[model samples]
Target chain A: MTDHDHDHHHDHSELSELELRVRALETVLTEKGYVEPAALDAIIQAYETKIGPHNGAQVVAKAWTDPAFKKALLDDASKAVGTLGHVGRTGDHLVAVENTPQRHNMVVCTLCSCYPWEMLGLPPVWYKAAPYRTRAVKDPRGVLADFGISLPKETEIRVWDSTAETRFLVLPMRPAGTEGWSEQQLADLVTRDSMIGTGFPKTPGAPS
Target chain B: MNGVHDMGGMDGFGKVEPEPNEPVFHETWEGRVMAMTRAMGAAGAFNIDVSRFYRESLPPTVYMTSSYYKKWFLALQDSLIARGYINDAEVKQGHAAAPAKDLKRGPFKLDDVKRVMTRGSFARAAEAPAKFKPGDRVRAKNINPVTHTRLPRYVRGHVGTIERHHGVHVFPDTAAKDAGEHPTWLYTVVFDGAELWGPDADPTVKVSIDAFEPYLEPA
Candidate 1:
């Protein structure tokens, strides 16, 4: 590992040292019949488009519109989410926490990036960075402030640290004036960060 | 282990920088690494816990300096070599020193890639019934083993209440070491902010973690 670091510093070339190493590794593995390029492309395509935050948005939209679904979701997220065809990988046992008028919920993985990849796709870079891991638990309000979200002074914050297998999804409170809105319209208001409890749903007239 | 990866309550890392309109993969190499790692994993090269342990075992300097996928690449190389899929000489030379040996299950193919990415096997299995239930007072064990652990350092030795029972799941510590699944009861434990971060912490804040049965004791 140190040798690679030394090589990285001495080689001031167009390609980054990390990129060069990855390219070389891929070359050797592919040449030796250990990896298939087509297989690699297929995996990338699936994650890029076939699966992502849209699945979570659909779940959130259903919860907002159907009180029965909301009750079922808060009761057993893994089972309720499965009803929407969103069940697999890292989402095997999910728990849904609701954000009500009195309390707000946020999710963080302090040990490692254990997110609901099946629902929300790969976590954003900031979610895996050190600062968010440390500060999210120590100063959650301050962290929310950094994300430009400020709750009412009297509202309580509940930070969920994903330490084990069970993953968490925060059901953000529905925005006002969206009454009788279609599920499709409500799904548009639901953002990835809102489901993670970093921000709120978009207002009705607000630009996406 | 009390590795540097446990950054629950440490300081001096810096502010969280949210990049606007970030691409799924920042560079071509990152995408390649992600795909390769997942492919290798699908081939039964190693389990998720073992992969995480390899990343956690890196030196702090290397772990901190490398980007996210870069770390994945490093861990992949180390795991592949350790499991006899590749060797140091071949890795250094960037070519096959000899023809690859026959794999029992065969390498992953393009036709199955999508299915592999979408399906996942559950690690949970039936175990002894849960010792505690929701509203039960419990305390985290103060342990710092030099092995993979799901228990975070900040919550160790602190008292919390059992919020929910998540049922039995594979214990990561033993699984990372190639041991049996050792499934145990899991629960969501909620700690008062003041108990974990001192009285200075906001009294209204509460922190919850999903802890395995072995990491908790009746308070």
Candidate 2:
């Protein structure tokens, strides 16, 4: 393979330092025969196209509509999620924390970004940044306020610091007025932040 | 190692600003870095704990300034070199000068992507019985090692209740050092927000963490 360069859009001068370093890293590894470029492409393609939070949305949707699944998910999240065929890296040992009227559950990986990638896909930039990591355990209410969520003062906020292998998924309380909605309809209302405990699922008839 | 990455409770970093409709990857290089890291990991270049140790061991200045993927990229290079798969000269020249070093596994192929993505569990059968159960009061030990560890600095020496018991799992503290897979019992320990912080802490907040058996003791 004569030095592959798919990035033909810009000259060397236009490429940022980080961009060039990434290209160089790949080149060296490929030349060493330690990695296949096709395999890298496949990995990227999987994250970019095949897997994501929508998978979690479907699981959340089913839990909202099915009573048995809701019980099973809260009991053992990894096994319940595996039943739906959503088991993989970063999602091996998942624990689903439910949000109730008396208590709310949120997740933050203060040490490193240990998110459930198989369920929630890649974490957002904010979730991985220093600010959220530092403040979430200290001032979770303030963090939730940044997300425009104002919970009742009496509602206990449970902040889960994902320090070990067990990843947490906040099972947001089902929004009202969707009594007869289908799982797909309910899933559409499930935002990534809602599952992360930063935001709630969209209200019925609200913009997606 | 109590590196800058254990950023819990300390102030001054600024507010959490979420990007609206954030793209999966901020830059093309970021996606490539992620893919390369994953692919190399699949080839058995290094385990996740070792990779994290490299990232955690970065100088405070570099660790604080680098973006998440940038950290991963730098860590991947360091891990590759440290594992003898590549060297600084090859990294700088952007090509291999010497014969490729043998890895524990061969090059990660495209066909292997699917099965690899469906990763296996880290949980192992317990060699001994669990010491505590849900509702048991326990305290996080204050001991800090100079190597890779999952216990954060904030929770050290603090008391919390064991809310749930997860079966034994691979201990990162040993795994990162090329030590044996000494699996141990894990639990979800819950702490009152006021206990973690001072009395000024919000009345509604409670924090929980997954603590391995070694990191905890009977309260």
Candidate 3:
């Protein structure tokens, strides 16, 4: 592929519903033929990959209790994350973004939806589209608001747009008041958005 | 050509209207196609194992989002190139060798394909020396050199905080190099909006990024 094909540097704009409909129709028509088999097996194998939803939750739960581990996670993720046993594929060089009270982070692979699927599980359908890519950069506030997350004006918002070369995964801050929560209790606080840096991990016994 | 990221601002478009769910039509066709293709692969297709993995694990976003045929075609290309079955040049050649496919269902040929499928490019990368360490504050280089690079354009020249020190690994850019080059040191660089977008950026906005050793200098 040409270098431009995989680059995720440019600002993304929105796509109307009509384009999506047309895209769907085109996709359906293209599928009406005898397909190649290796491709099928490849798709199957990717899903069967060890980096699924379960692995991502464990990373969050571990971070909740172990401050030293969190420091390690921030210092050298690929090796540090290994302490929690999540590696391989996309995460060999994992980068974990922390969302604190004054700052929030969000990740989107604008070019090709290059996600940390292994650690975060499957991505939402909208993530692969162009609108989310363009609008996310141009109007971070608006996009976050749609997801019902509006950062305070005093707080800063940074969007990490992933490209073909690098992928991103979020490491949510340990919530307050859950000083002695179990692993399962911590896992419950992790949401898909938190892993992507859109929403904060719900604090234990906090609002839904 | 339109910029690759211009999916939005696609003209005076309206809201995404909902359509009736057509899961069956999708499943039956995509399933049949994938199965038949995999069977063809079993017959006399290209490298079977590598093909199998690439086909299955391609960017699911692309597979589901792009035109169905585009996804299949690209997936095939990625596998071919990845396994060195064909390079860009070979692909450009248009006429490549037939896979060492065993006669259909004669017997599974796992060993033969294994070598090609699992080839690693670790030997080609040039390992980083000195450079920087963890907690280093570096500004990403703004270089726009035209070579194979893993550094994204948006992140170039931005200032960031180095989060981790991932041990050197193979650099995918020089992967085609027949000789050796150890992988470079890679780290995360966080950038503030004012740093990337100036006045337009929010005062408090901060964006962190991954920076290869070459893409950074001491800030």
Q: In every candidate, what fraction of the native interface contacts is reproduced?
A: 0.65, 0.80, 0.15
Candidate 1 stretches with Cα past 4 Å from truth are A1-13, A85-91, B99-105, B119-123
Q: lDDT scores for all predictions? A: 0.84, 0.86, 0.53
In model 2, which residue pairs have backbone atoms overlapping below 3 Å? none
lDDT of 3 by residue, B32-89 (tens): 3433334334433443323433433555555434534245456655653554434454
- The residue-by-residue lDDT of candidate 1 on A67-116, one tens digit each, is 99999999988778877754333346778889999999999999889888
User: Residue B131 of model 2: what lDDT?
Assistant: 97
| Candidate 2 local lDDT, B96-169, one digit each (tens) | 88788877778877887886776668999889999999999999999789999999999899999999988999
Instruction: Put down candidate 2 lDDT per residue, A24-91, tens digits, no spaces.
Output: 88998898887788988888888888778887888889999999999999999878887875433344
Docking class of predicted structure 1: medium
Model 2 Cα shift for residue A193 (angstroms): 0.3
**What does DockQ come to for candidate 2?**
0.51
Best by DockQ: 1
Model 2 ranges with Cα > 4 A deviation: A1-13, A85-91
DockQ ranking from best to worst?
1, 2, 3
Clashing pairs in model 1?
A: B1-B147
TM-score of each prediction? 0.93, 0.95, 0.61
State residue A75's C-alpha deviation in candidate 2, in Å: 1.3
